[model samples]
Target: MITFQLSKQEKVVKSINSPSNNISHCAFLACSHSPQCTTQNKTCCAYILKHSLVFIDTFFKHHNLSYVIIYGTLLGAVRNKTIIPWTKDIDIGIIDMTYLFTKKIRDELYQHGFHLFESFGLPRLCVHKNISNRTLLATYDRRHKPPASTLELKVYIDLYSMYRIYGAQTTSKTPVFLIKTGGSFHALISFQNRVTIDEQTFPTIDNIEEHLVYFYTKEYMHGIMTE
Candidate 1:
């Protein structure tokens, strides 16, 4: 029998190639499901929120388009002055835009490493990051699984189209603004104004509290805070 000795470089390469050493730093920590990993996940989500907002603001400004903070995101901005801890996404509404615009926005996002997914039959745009070889592991609770591939990319910005409803009895062609929610479009007649949240300014309904109640009901606010 002949015995062979491996060189330093060969040894290092062999160790790296071993199955035990193949685990990625992120994958190892994420798989552990420890509190530290949970905190890291939240931190990653926060970064995504900040970066996504900046990207959206830049894109809209370049396109000469205006967007309004709406839904839960609007509520968080108005009350907490920051993103809600439990909030997983951002919501914004564009007035008088068509679904065709989403295609353009998707293409623009692709250039910046984001992939756009449109909800079927709804004027909604969800953006995610492109990644490879990532799999979501079931959590201890089984209900909450950490985002598999796009660790920091789990956060998404939702873009909704606002339209003005045309009443059957009215003959005037004046444009109106309506927001779609729960599979139906509701009239939005509130005046919009600029508001600053976490040093970033965006358009929101002038009467924010009332607007939120109108869309989500007073009980919804209570539930959000309590739950």
Candidate 2:
């Protein structure tokens, strides 16, 4: 069972219950092309990611919280006009992290049919109620178990806090900062760029080419990811 625990400051629990391994339809690998994948099924992982991002974007806007898509999620958005066919989770950076820990936000998430949980040692928000099939296939935790009576799939959205690196002190003389989570830098980004996909606009780094090159090198424009 999923445990819902909340501290005075931290509003989420440790992790979710293990999920079953009966998802034969889940490829867990990037699709050769996203256009072919998303059109096939509504409950597919790609659609799950799309819907998850839409919800978060709307949620943050409604609460007046500033956020931007970053890392692989941003890359896919800029390149494919959709999430990477093999996207396992969503990544976003909030301008203010403290707002996420308040009791009000916690209640709002729960009221919206989501259970915030920690996975991979980092906090992530997840929901299963919005999807048509009502299944939650835990992406990272695939342990064999008797099929529970609840949903069989879980879509997790990883959250990171954005910070400004004040003062320009680089050789190129442009301010650059790192988005860190769990003591590791998620991405090196600068400036803000507005991106529109499928008529839905979202914020990203203005220098997207540099952002992609900084992480994926020049080949990213061709839809190649080299870590």
TM-score of each: 0.58, 0.66
Tens digits of per-residue lDDT for model 1 on 1-227? 11123211211101112221111212211123122222224334443454557666787778777677777778767666656656656788776354224446546655654444433333333332232312221211223443343233235566666654444222233333455555443433344476666778776654566566766677655545511
**Model 2 scores what on Cα lDDT?**
0.56
Q: Which parts of model 1 have CA positions greater than 4 angstroms off? A: 1-42, 99-104, 123-153, 165-176, 183-192, 219-227
- What C-alpha lDDT do the candidate models reach, one value each? 0.48, 0.56
Clashing pairs in 2: 135-152, 135-153, 136-152, 136-153, 136-154, 137-152, 137-153, 137-154, 193-204, 193-206
Off by over 4 Å in 2: 1-35, 129-154, 169-176, 181-192, 223-227
Angstrom error of the Cα, residue 124, model 1: value is 5.1
Consecutive 10-residue window with the lowest summed lDDT within model 2: 1-10
Q: CA RMSD for every model?
A: 19.8, 9.8
Query: Could you tell me the TM-score of candidate 1?
Result: 0.58
lDDT of 2 at 37: 58
Give the winner by lDDT: 2
